[model samples]
Target: MSAIVSHRLHLPGTSPVHRVPAEVKIVCAVVAVFAVVATPREMFWPFAVYAAGVIVAWRSARIGLRWIAPRLLIELPFVVLAILLPFAAGEPRTTVLGLSLSTTGLYAAWGIIAKGTIGVAISLTVAATTSIRELPGGLSRLHVPAMIVVIVVLMLRYVDVIADEAARMRLARISRGDDPRTIRQIGATARGVGNLFLRSYERGERVHLAMLSRGFTGVITEYGAEPATPRQWVLGIVPAVAAICVCACALVVR
Candidate 1:
């Protein structure tokens, strides 16, 4: 079976951000995220600056608001939780628009929304710029455990395989005059899901055997990845260092 080669989230581009080594991007993203996380929830101004930095990164990557906006839908559930936090959490109550609200909860909710929004934005920016194929090489360069990298590589490769298999099974069921819309037909839908799981498991077994026969090893090695130069590392790390500095300033102000 032909495996999917690219991530659905990856937007192909020739921007300099896209050209930076994947390891650098990973490190930068992680550092920035940590900085965002370290900033006190009460120190709201820093999060705004953090968001502006992310927006700059987006522009540098040639990504636009239109591209980033729809992807933000994935965070809607968390947004809902944030919205409910002021209501559900306990604290000294303050009246807002004649409605009783928790003072502490209001701050907590804002923190969640602000931090979550920036975190998701950063993640989408990275996903938009980085190809799925490059991630394993990046992780490998970070000295991450080989088995973890292999798992990540294989998971990315096989996700589409599982999805395609499920689609084909659904089509087969439809061809057999199975109407999945009826309440009485729920049993068939359940069975189809279970069958799909078993088929995927069997496929995995066969693929493992085939890999072993072909001299497959547990570790995934990428020989073709070019080494990251000192210049690249410097360029890549600047944004993360800047984020850390902003976080430090925010802490000092707090």
Candidate 2:
């Protein structure tokens, strides 16, 4: 499980960024994102500063652009929506390269793209530096609800299991000459999905039973996580502080 989590997102590194306590990194990432969201959409310079901060973080974490760039494709749906905004939005339009675009929509699109990109970038950077095992402890340290933390941890732990199960199911179907790509096989595909869900539910019940047999308690005990020191907090929070300052300046200038 540790190997899977490490390979999926956490880049193994000994840099200062990776060395910071997970709780500190979590707080910093959240604060920086909040600062970005608070900034006015009309202002563009602040986002550049935010991007620069993310770049510095990436550099510190020794995460290359090649590693992070592909992950940013997760925001493609938002980008598509943003692209349509200028065309579909209401009046107050301006001509751009022979196309009439909504002024408000343009700003909205820019806000979506800039904020989404920066948020995703920051998230990837944090993920690259912090392993999945560290997340529950970090959230717990941050005073998040215990149940919510448990749910997140369990979900992360079992996602790969569910994915592997789905893959195996697909292979079985293909081996039986079931071509899911055909429109005629849509019903079969739906049935396959339902079967997978049932299997997953049964598996979950068995796992829960096993846990109870092993004296499972409601509380999840975190191991190997040390408390963050003041120095670590200060160093980790510098980027977030910079973001907040930029947000404030953007608001003032606006």
Candidate 3:
């Protein structure tokens, strides 16, 4: 599980950011995202400040823009939605370079893009620093519901498994001369998806039964990492504190 998550997201760093407890990092990331989301979208400078804070975090974690940029592609669909908003949104429109767009939609798009980008960046930072093994303990320490923690842990554990299954299935299809890139293969692709779902469902059932046989309970054991010291918490929380301050100032100035 750790190997799977580490290969996909964790950067395996020795920086102070990596040294901070997972729970502390989780709390800080959540607080920072809340601060960004709470700030008025019209206040653009605050987002910039929030972005700067993320950059500082990256530096502290010894992660580079090059490393983070590729991962940001996961948010491209939201970016597309943001792009469409100004055109498809209701009236109260303005003309830009011969294109009429909604005034409200413009702000909405900015809000989505700005807030969403910062949120993803913050999340990736946390994922890069924190291992999958640390997550259950972190959420447990944060008093997250046991069921929710278990669900999250299970989801993370199986994501790589499901992904590998999909890859193998795809390879099998390709070997059988099914060209997935062509339009005619759309039907095959859809069938492949349906088959994948059924396979995953069966696997889940088998795993659940095995767990029950082994005296499985709904609760997950807490993570083995020691609790964060006061100093560690303070050090880890500085970015969130700064983000909150920025948000407060943005509200005041707005």
Candidate 4:
């Protein structure tokens, strides 16, 4: 399946990172997230540096801005909230840049904005590049409980089917000139959703029964992951080192 619903997840290149083990991508994302979070909360420069680091890694991994940027919308709410944090704190403080804002609160807001944005971008980049199929195997290899993987696998496989069914039903309504933009249409839409949910529930039961009849195991085995090659290491190290250096600089500056 394509990434971002229909977008191609894999970049077209022979970069070594394209062949890296799935587990490594997961680890890199997690470690990078931690790096962003672990930086001191009082500085902004480190976070900018952190963003640069992730971008560098993305470039090295052969992932383009277009490939990775679609997911930035996910971070918009968080960033907006983070930007408001300083004003919300209500501590008596000095104004910065002609705005009556608290000092520590401003710093706090900056901390969240910078770190949170970096974290989301890094996470999205990993998601953009990594294959969905590899995720199950990576999780299984990393000692994640097999049941968890099983549930994830089931949900991913079925959710799209359920969604298409919902869309088809919606199209049927639209063809009948069911105007959905009014408050009066809300009930109809709710009913449509409820109907879809019921259908999905029944389908899930039938699938489970079929699986049982076929002697399905609770845990599906991963075909297994190839080793994380050196290319992956290089791709990882650029960002990791950049993030660490930026954090160090922030710590020193603070």
**Reference-based lDDT, residue 101, model 1:** 90
Q: Write the per-residue lDDT of candidate 4 for residues 82-111, one digit (tens) a residue.
A: 778777777678877888887777778777
In order of lDDT, best first, we have 3, 2, 1, 4
lDDT of 3 by residue, 1-254 (tens): 55886888889989999999999999999999999999999999999988888898899899988989999899999999999999999989999999999999999999999999999999999999998888888898899999999899889888889999999999999999888999999999999999999999999999899888988898776646898999999888988999999999999999
Could you arrange the candidates by TM-score from highest to lowest?
2, 3, 1, 4
Q: Which residue pairs in model 4 clash with each other?
A: none
Per-model CA lDDT versus the true structure: 0.86, 0.90, 0.92, 0.72
- Model 1 — which ten-residue stretch has the worst lDDT? 1-10
**What is candidate 4's TM-score against the reference?**
0.79
CA RMSD of all predictions: 2.6, 1.5, 1.6, 3.4
Query: Considering every candidate listed, which one attains the maximal lDDT?
Result: 3
Candidate 1 residue-wise lDDT, 81-153, digit = tens: 8889789878798999998998888988888888888989888888788777678788988999998998877
Instruction: Give each model's clash number.
Output: 0, 0, 0, 0
Better of 1 and 4 by lDDT: 1
Better of 1 and 3 by TM-score: 3
Residue 236's lDDT within candidate 1 is 90
